[model samples]
Structures are given as structure tokens and as C-alpha cells.
Target: MNDVPVAVAAMPSAEGTAVARAAAVVGGPPAVRCTGLARRFGRRWAFSRVDLEVAAGARLLIMGANGSGKTTLLKVISTLIPPSLGAVQIFGHDAGADPAAARARLHLLSHSAGLYEDLSGADNLLVLSRLLGRPLVDPVALLARVGLAPRPEPVRTYSAGMRKRLQLAALLLKDPPLTLLDEPFAALDPAGCGAVEALISGLSGTVIVASHQVGRAARLCDHALLMHEGAARWQGPAARAVEAYTALHGIDNADGGG
Candidate 1:
């Protein structure tokens, strides 16, 4: 792990410290910049010609119908997959030219829990800490912070909401400069949703969330982008997200699942 390029050294051991560290870099180049970003799978384009800029410390909400390319856009920004056309810059670092630098400053919490089902929640954090070349500071406290209780049972026994909470705990441990979340509000109870909202509110760095829970997500975000058929249909203040989405589709209820 000593050779790992991830910036785990001197990483914040607590959420408060992480917030403070993120605040120190609040103003600079845009946290994320996409120029003509597009992704294609065989014959169909998942998303195309998507150009956007997210400022540091901004919370952006991405709303669109199912298969409208919200997840694909996030994957490209996270550098998990390359764009068929276009470039992505994370805090001024080109993702294509220098992916490692971009990755070190961001964390992507995708739809999958990305956890080891055979490992306990605490053990999962331990492994991640070692992989990032950091010491396991306090998994118990971290789990609690995400509204998860310490358990001896492996992650395979955890519920969907519990798994989401654990994934959030892992994100806090990294405390990257940019955070990308895909359907973060899915599979959570009211309490779990509240916990997620609180955590997002506390983050001082850039945050991008792709979710179908338009009403709730819009409130937490400062900026909004609506995608339709592989293109950006609208981009503006979060307050008008529902209106923009409604006007495009003529659907009064944008709260439906994606």
C-alpha cells in the first residue's frame, strides 16, 4: 500500500477535520469541468455533448428518467470509464491525461455497495484503510456516524439501507475533494434518508448526486442539471429543477423512481 498513489497519508481521521481540510481548498479551478462529454455503448449513445461546470463546495443534482444516462455521466466523471468523446477536468487535472491525480481527489459511490459480502462492516473499513495506506482510526465511531451499529455479522447479512450507510462511512474515511453519488436516496428509510442528507450538508467540497427523488434532492443541491435522451435538457438553479423537468416531459410528478 506504500506504493499506492492514492492520497491516504495525512488524511483526516475525523469528519470534522475532513470538512475543515476541504474548506481550505474551496476556491480555485472548477471542481469539475466537462467539455462535450459523451459516452457510447456499441450503437447507442448513453450521453452526448454534455458540457457542465461545478464549482468547489457546490452541491449539484442530476435528474433524468431511467436509462437517460445519469449513471453513465457519473461513471465518466469518476474516471471509471473513458468518454467516447470529450475531456473531463477534476480540480484542473485532466482525467484522461492524468487519471491517477484526478482519482486521488474524488470518490464515487455508485449504485453498487462495492463491499466484500464476506467481511464484516468494521473489517471492510479496515481493509479500505490499509489499501489507502492509512491506519484504521476508529471504524466503530465512523459506522455510528453513518447511523450504523457495530456488528459481528458480515456485510452479507446487512440490509440495503445498512449497506448504503456503510458505504457512506467509507466515503467519509476518504474525504475526497469531489464526491459523486448515484441514486444515493434509494433503498433508505426516513431515518436513513435524514442521515444521508445531514452528511451531504456537512461536506465542504464539491458534491454531485444523480437521483430520481427530485423534490428532496433538489432541496439539498444548489445547482441542477436535467438530462433527457443523452443530452442536457436544462441547467440552472435548483429551485426550478422540478419545473424544468416538468416542462420538458409534461409530467407533473418528477418524484417517481428513475
Candidate 2:
């Protein structure tokens, strides 16, 4: 197959370190940048007046209600959907101007399992590996890493947890610079959640996980961004972010399912 020259994000200097943009005034490394981000379905503004910056290798968690623009904000950042009224910059490159370069390092795992039920777990992973333009890793090892050890069965026969884990294995491929996990913990067993948390604990790179699971996010992330009606209300440390959310919403059930 012809390796079409897919432009990679201009490699950042200083050994994988991104430009740190703590303040909007001075420029620095940015994994994600949003200015005046707004989305409108019709007359209603989903969100507006949102500006945010995140440095390299920071794991970000988005906290909000089901319809409060958490997913919308993620979509815009991942370049899946365009913001109607805002400009987004990812990895120091303009999202609208050079999305391809940004997307090379971007991986978005949607709410649904983007796996083929008809194909076996190995086949699904191999297909993704080819698209990533990299050699596929050991399927059995990948499956075992995610606790799906007994392999070589049709994916359609697998349980929802198994499928989700398989999708996660594929997501780990390409070593994407930015990873977006939407409700990543949905439909996992207690053991699986703990395993995933352990796996994500020291994960190196930029990540944005949109979920209402504040407790999990607190343990798993370094930074947290709160979105309400499509705008950023607060952004800071994980613990403080959780505290702010507890004050606004409540501590009850902030962990989400189970």
C-alpha cells in the first residue's frame, strides 16, 4: 500500500515537551487552545465565551452535565466538529488552518465502541494498525493487557465490557499525542475500572477525558476544566476542580456509575 504523506504535527523540541501556556498573555506550549468557543444548533447558544489553555503532558478532565457541552467541547478540540463562533488551536497549530497536522496526533474514542462486531478482535486491531502506518502489536498481549485474555472468538459474541476493552486497545495504537476519552469508564466491572485507572495513572502525553466521574477524574487527571452550557466556568487542579463542582452541583453521585 502506498504510504500517503500524511503530515505529522511539527515535532516539538525539548524531548516531547509541549509549549506551556499557563497564561493567555505570553505564548508557550499548548496541547489545546480555545478562544471564544461557541456552538449554536439554531437560536440557542450551546456555549460561548470560552477560552482555555493546557500545557503538554497534562491529563484534562471535563466535568459537566449530560447536555452541558462537555461532549461538544471535546468534539471541537478533537476536530470532529467545528465551533461556530470560536477559534481552536491544538499543539500550537490552528485547528481550522492545519487540522490535518493536529489530527495526526489526535485520537478520539467515541461514546460507542467503534469496533466491527463481525470481525475478531485481532482483525479489528490489525486494520487500525495499518491505517496508523505502523506495525501492529501482539493482539493477544494487547487483549491480555485489557483483561481480555481468552482470545480468537468473534467480537459479536463478546460482552460489552470486552468490546469496550478491545476498542481501548486500538485507541492506544498510533501513540497519538492527544487522546479523548468520552465516558471512558462506562460499562466496566470494578476490577476493570481499577485496572484501567492503574493503566492511566502514569500515561505520558496530553489527554482530555469528558466524563461526570469526578472522583475517577480526580485520581486520574492533573488538570480539570468545568463546562456549563458550552462555556468554561473554571479550570485548575484536579482536587480544586472537584471541589468547585461539589460546591456547584453536589458531592452526591459525582463519581457517576457505581
Q: Which candidate is the best by lDDT?
A: 1
> CA lDDT of each candidate?
0.82, 0.71
List TM-score per model, in order: 0.88, 0.84
lDDT, candidate 1, 104-223, per-residue tens: 999999889988999999999999999877787789999989988899999999999999999999899888989999988889888788788788778767888998788777766767
Off by over 4 Å in 1: 1-27, 256-258
Model 1 poorest ten-residue lDDT run: 1-10
Query: What's model 1's overall lDDT?
Result: 0.82
Looking at model 2, residue 209 earns an lDDT score of 84
Residues 1-258, model 2: lDDT tens digits? 221111112223222222331222235457777777778778887777767766666677788877888877788888888889878888788989998988887888777778788888988888888877888758778767777775677798988778777877887766677788887787888877776666555355777788888777666666677776666677666657667777778656676653
Best by TM-score: 1
How many pairs of residues in model 1 come into backbone collision?
0
The regions of model 2 sitting more than 4 angstroms off are: 1-28
Residue 9 displacement (Å), model 1 = 31
